[model samples]
Target: MIEILNPAELARAREAGALVAGILQTLRSRSAVGTNLLDIDRWTKDMITEAGAQSCYVDYAPSFGRGPFGHHVCTSVNDAVLHGRPHDYALADGDLLSLDLAVSLGGIVADSAVSFVVGGSEPPESLALISATERALSAGIAAAGPGARTGDVSAAIGAVLGGAGYPVNTQFGGHGVGSTMHQDPHVSNTGRPGRGYPLRPGLLLALEPWVMADTADLVTDADGWTLRSATGCRTAHSEHTIAITDDGAEILTAPERARV
Candidate 1:
C-alpha cells in the first residue's frame, strides 16, 4: 500500500527516522573485532524496546524469505549483502560489515543501512565497494523530489554503481515506506529516466543500493534468510529513507555532521 503521510504523520516519520539513525550509528560504533552479529541484534532489540519502538523485521514473514525474519537488525558481513539475518559469527579485523535497520515509532516507520570496515583495517576493495554504494545512495536521494519519476532516482543510483563496475541485482532494491515498513512504488537500482511512478509529496521511500564484489547472482545461506554473493566475494550496501517534499527531497536518515 502507498501511504501518503499528512503533516503530522510526516513529523512522526522524522522522529522515527531520527531514532533509527541514532540507534544504527550507535550500534555501528560499538561493533568491532570480536563482536558477534547475534550480539548486535540483541543490542538493537534492547535499544528499540527501551525506546518504545517496534521492530519491522522480527516478525516479517514475506514470501521472498523462508519465514519470519526473527532478527532485530540485518548484519551483512563480507560476502553477505541484503537479507542478512544476524548469526553467531564474530567480526574479524578488516571485515566489511553492513548493518540495516528499521523501526516503527509514533505510528511511522524509517529504515536505513550503513557499511563499514571493522578494526580500522583499510581494505582497499572493501572501501571501494562501500564508497560506491554510498555515492549511489546519494545520487538516488538527490533525484527524489515531488514530480520526479522513480526511474530518475533509479537511473541516478545505477549510474554510480555501474560506473564503479558493480553489477546490481534487481531482485531487491528500494521501496515506499510509511506507517508500515514496506509499501508501494518499487525503485529498482537501474532504470531509464522519466519512467515508473511519479514522485509526490508525502511519499517516503527507502533507497538502498547494494552490490556484490563480483557477480550479481545471489545464494541463500543455510539459514534461509541471509543473501550472499555467489562467489563469496566481499560486498557492501548503502541505504536511506527519504521523503518527497514540495521543494525537494528531504533525507530522513542522513548521518548527523556531529556524529560523523
Candidate 2:
C-alpha cells in the first residue's frame, strides 16, 4: 500500500523515527567485543517497551521469512547482511556488525540500519564496504523529492555501490513504510532512472543499500532468517526512513546530533 501520510500522521512518524534511531544508536554503542547477540535483542525490547513503542519485527510474519521473527533487532555480523536474526554468539574485535531495526510509535512505523566495526581491529575491507553502503544511502536520499521517481533514487544508490566495485542485489531492498512496516513501491538498490513509481509529497520510503564484498549471491543460515554472503566475504548495509515533502526528502531516522 502506498500511503501519503497526513500532517498528524507525519508527526507521529517523526516520533517513531526518532525512537528507531535512538534505539539503533544505543544498541550500536552497547555492542562490542564479548557482547552477546541475544543481549542486543533484549536491550532493544527493553528500550522499545520503555518508550511505549511496538516492535515491527518480533511478531512479524512475512512470506519471505519464517513466521514470527521472534527477535527485537537484526544483528548481522561479518559475512551476514540482511534479516540477521539475533543468536547466541558474542562479538569479536574487528567484527563488522550491522544492526537493522523497525518499530512503531503512535501507530506509525520507521526503519533504519547501521554498520560498524567492533572493538579495536579495523579491517580495511570491512571499512570500505561500510563506507560504500553509507555513500550509496546518501546518494539515494539526495535523489528523492516530490517530483522524483523511485527509479531515480535506486539509480543514484546503484551508482555509488557500483562505482565502488560492489555487486548489487535486488532480491531484497528498500520499501514503503507507514502504519505497518514493509509497504508497497519496492525500491531496488539498482534501477534505471525515470522509471518506477513517481514520488509524491507525504510519501515515506525506507532507502537501504547493502552489498557483499565479493558476490551478489546470498545464502540463508540454518536459522531461516539470517542472510549471509555466498562467499563468506564481509558485508555492509546502510538505511534510513525518509519522508517526501514539497521542498525535498526529510530523513526521519537520522540520529540525533549531540548538543555540545
TM-scores of all candidate predictions against the true structure: 0.97, 0.98
Model 1 weakest 10-residue run by lDDT? 251-260
Model 2: how far residue 135 lies from native, Å: 0.4
Off by over 4 Å in 2: 257-260
Give the per-residue lDDT of model 2 (tens digit) for 1-260: 88999999999998888889888888988998999999999999999999998999989988888868999999999999999999899999999999999999999999999999999899999999999999999999999998899999999999999999999999999999999899999999999999999999999999999999999999998888999999999999999999999989999999982110
Q: In lDDT terms, how accurate is model 1?
A: 0.91
Off by over 4 Å in 1: 257-260
- Clash total of candidate 1: 0
> RMSD to native for every prediction?
1.6, 1.6
Give the whole-model CA lDDT for all candidates, comma-separated: 0.91, 0.93
Model 1 over residues 29-114: C-alpha lDDT tens digits?
89989999989999999999988999999999998898799999999999999889997899999999999999999989999999
